[model samples]
Target: MSDRIDKSLTRKKLDKTLKPHWVWAIALGSSIGWASFVMPATWMGEAGPLGVILGLTLGALLMIVISISYGVLIRNYPVSGGEFAYAFLGLSRLHAYISGWFLTLGYICIVALNATAFSLMLKFIFPNFIEQVKVYEIAGWEVYLTEILLATILIGIFTVLNIRGTTISGRMQFIFVAILIVGVLTITIGMTSSAETSFSNLTPLFTPEISALAAILTIVAIAPFAYVGFDNVPQAAEEFKFSSKKALTLIVLAILFAAAIYSLMILATGVAAPWQEISQANHAWGTGFVVQEVLGTGGLIVLATALTMGIFTGLNGFLISSSRVLFAMSRGKVLPKAFSNLHSRYNTPYFALIFAAVIAIIAPWFGREVLGWVVDMSSVGVSIAFFYTTYTAYKLLKWSEQDEGYNPELHIVSPGKKVVTLLGMIASVSFLVLLLYPESPAALGMESIVALLVWIAIGAIFYMIRRKELAKYTREELAYLILGKDQFKLKKEEE
Candidate 1:
């Protein structure tokens, strides 16, 4: 593993061209996609606008705590694997592989989810274009051949875009995110000004039937999915062309920004469309209907265009992040070395991007209903990764306090931060459990649970097969593999 790292360093490196703001763009774009437009209806249906607001508020607070822990970890390590790197450093190789597996699953699911979302967005905008092409039926939902083809084409396009280079993806992310923000703001302003929309629509803001705690918990359970992309900052840490402080600041800002965007989307939907109508309509097109009502057909087109751009940004960002995670895992010897191979010209993990794209291309065939199950299951995986990362952060803080060579300047792990991480772990685990509840909004049904189990089982088999080979490397060797010898040397000098 160490030899591979040393050899690779001479061949290529992840480009260090991304500034702090570009990092923010990736995070923001990875989130705030079709999910932002679609999910609020579910939240608003279960709870009203006020309930949704409260849920998002509490979820944001929890995500802030998680982000702070991530900021500290990334500041110290500044590696591409994000949680996988942290776990390898603070815990063990086995722990790191497990974290990487779950995180990778989440990213792949997001890629697939967003591809399907893009197709759905098109369906909303042009309802008649492909309505006649029925593929199959699953769980009472009709699967369309055209939708599957569109999703596959999208996955292929995004895979190529990502394989081209991180610079191209980052540039695309910024443009799309800018359009999304402007579209959202325009919709909000227009909706507020329209006489058709009334403040009275916000009446009975909280759900009359559901308790506040339950409503908030519902949103919190799915919040991981909504906020998953902010952590992409850490996954691209090696590519950042800025100070660690700036990177950390941008990460926090991205979290806050995404939370605000999600909340505002919910507010706009509630204000622009009647709660009863939104609740009864297909949650996927609920926001579209709101836009149509508030801004007419022209505004709906603009919003769809912006969301389509958002889908591209999201797919690009996740591809960038997921490939890095695979590259790091491969470099660490947990997976095959082929995954770590960067394109000669692009300096991106081309093999890993294609691997993820293959998954995205095939996933849509299961139909959107099953994909929803996959998305929820992916959130559970993400929460598990979050819990492990937070636990590792707390463990590292304690270790730093005891190690004589530990330098406070290199790592920011205070007792207060430890407490926050501990809280984050609890929240993460609670959400994981909540996601498993049979009646929870994002609950994993039997089929989804079986699918998740099968995925983990496959990972377990691979781990068993590679366990002996992976065990050849000592912790020091593993660290060198992940951080490179120069970084390891710098850490030693700092300590």
Candidate 2:
């Protein structure tokens, strides 16, 4: 039911109205940004430096591989489907629906988690002022004058920028990205300057202890959450001056930048604090404590501020992407039509955005762990989606229709694509196992399994509800929907 949104709201193409940087801003924001502050802080506090490193490594590899596979997909059909397009073009409609649900749910959780984190951090940084002005509960348990006011103000800021238009939001992200780079560089160099970091720490060893292995895998499970921003490339496709090859360039560049940056920060975090403190991060936060310890109150302040900015941008990025998914789906007639309405003045997926925003923010309350956990579980969903897609790509390459974009000979002999696709497949499947392992130090464990089951069940129900309408649409419709109709029409030559 991916592209098969309700008939009245059938899948349609996006308006070509954005700059290329907007694409990079949102995609890169989701892909890496400043999420580093959240993880190793918790991990460093609870597990150890090794656990934090392992968690980051796992997430990065998973995201890179999965995103690379998606990169190949979007290169062929650059548009806003995200997983919706991936499933619609490569796999079953049911699978596409599942992908949509996973990404949607994952990002919704991100928004709420970020908002909550933002509120808490603001209170932490400026306790007295936030206190006197409070109007809501602390972590949903106790009321406070300051926290409420802070949450209200921040949300309002984000909402206004979002509602005003994409241009304003894009500019905001551009500014944040500058700040993000400074914070990331500062943290990385600060940690690097300290004596503990060594090439020795990153040396590979396969001998895995039961405890170490489980902890490593668990942390790794959540690791993919770190690299999820690749999907945003497709979300920004409508804005690109060129459509074809847009997806390929965007994904590759985004991944390389993110990987290098993350690798640097991870090494820095390790060097700044001992393995013992970084691992113990599971209790209060994660490795953030060590950063505070080493960087002094000033460093901590910068990181916390960076986290706040990163989380907000990440939240906004997802809200933007998820709405497009729904909008495309609604146009396809797989779901209700009301989801596709755009605000004439805002030129945004106004209703879809607002609806998703409200739901995304409040939904995290039900979950055991809000932000990272939600993002991790979403990775689980995408893992399933990627497996389906890689298999689909293999199958499509083997026997796809001639007129469509299938390349049978390339699958076997295109060594580079073959290797990357295989890597993508392995990385995805590995993350799935990591998420399920009970003893993982990253803490996903069996609960992740339950989360996956619940999300799948929900997705299944949604698919079944829309099956009848979707059945009428043939592969031809699916193809057009995947490759935006506007994309096929080349611009008339300006004489």
Candidate 3:
């Protein structure tokens, strides 16, 4: 058994080739997606242009706090597990497992969400070609065979790409992110230059259907889904070819970039199309419709191509980040060791990537409406992880101050850092509670709640089974047991 574990540790190490730009690309690609293209209209429908701006701005500010907390923690403990590692170091083994479990679930749901989003985009672009053949129904939503097949095909392709290696995935992210930026620029130029569009179109920017506070809270609840990918940088900390400070800076930049794009999207959509007309249109393809209005058929074609690329980057980024979480759990003995297996040639967590792909493929069979549920549920999971991470950051900072050997140069501890960390934790908790609020726009359906419960139950059962295997060893023994001497030595040398 010892021999087997040792061999696994040495054979399954992650490759460290990602530079600062690649890390930034992954974070951006993961956050900005087809949803970003259309969510402006949806936000406008809920709260008007002014409301959308306020909500996104507040949400972005909160996300910046969360991102800074993440940066501080990653700087102190730069590892692959991300929140999981922080929780383990500051809290306990059990807390670490739970944090990792929540993050992994969130990442998997994001992958599934993007796969469904991709299929929906295809239907919007080729409404005639992708005919809907209703297979069955779930939760009052009709399931279509064509959509299911399309999503599965996309999942399969990206799964193969991820299993090939992070280098391929990172390069793909860079290319697609470049295209997405160009698309955003084109839309902005088209909207501003169009004679038909006017500032008057954005009248009544503030609507009174909902209170400003409620509107902002609604956006905050959904913000986790929008800004989900920035934390992916820390999840691949070991794979970065830069200092922790640089990696942290890149994560912050990614968040700001995503925020700017989202805000601009809302502004452009509001100015180009009347709020009432946009509200009445098919909300899923609202952005594409706006492009059609501003730039005609040629613009629509270009946007579709760019949006397709964005979806691919999103799928790839989530896959890479999620697999690393699974790999970390397996390495820590919280999950089955098989999940830690890497591709011999590519040095990627192939088994974990395949498992995530299976989930993504299965998600579309439930229909596109369920995508909302998945996104909402994922927000809850992400919030839980964020809360723990922030809490851990606070605890670690306090602990470092009390330690005699603590060096400010090696650790990130400041007098006001605790306050920011506490605010991050509070904000995360607020988002989680807001998501469950019945009247909130981002409220989770009963089905999503049940789905979340089932996932948690599965994690609980897995923990129990793994606990028995780990009980015979002490904490230090278990740590060393999973990470063999050779790998430990390698890590020490690298540090």
Best by TM-score: 1
Tell me the tens digit of each residue's lDDT in model 3 across 1-495.
343233333434688878778889999989887677757787787878777777777887898888878888777566787887766655667887888888987888788777777767777778765667879988777677887788888889989988887778788889889888888888777787789788787767666677777766677777888888988988888787778778768887888888888887787788877876887776658877877878899988777776787788788888888989998888777888889888888888899999988877777777767766766677788888888888877765644466755555434557588788889999998898788878767788897897788878998998888888755444543344333222221111110
Clashing pairs in 1: none
Candidate 2 weakest lDDT stretch, 10 residues: 486-495
Q: What clash pairs does model 3 have?
A: none
Candidate number with the higher TM-score (1 or 3) = 1
Tens-digit lDDT track of model 2 for 1-495: 334333342444445666666677677777774465655544444434565566566666556666656666566556665667666655556666767777677766666666666655655566676457334343344445455445445555676667667777777776776677677788777766765455454322212343566556655665566667667666666545555455656665666666666656666666654444454444344435666667778878777766766776777777777677777677655667777777777766677777767676455334325344455677776567667656544433323234344444323234466566777778767767666655434446455566667877877887888888877765545445655542222212221
**Per-candidate TM vs. native?**
0.91, 0.80, 0.90
Residues 402-474, candidate 1: write the lDDT tens digits: 6665655444537788788889888888888888878876566787798789888998998999999887765
lDDT of 2: 0.61
> Where does model 3 exceed 4 Å of error?
1-12, 399-412, 437-442, 478-495
Question: What is the TM-score (0 to 1) of candidate 3?
Answer: 0.90
By TM-score, rank the candidates, best first. Answer: 1, 3, 2
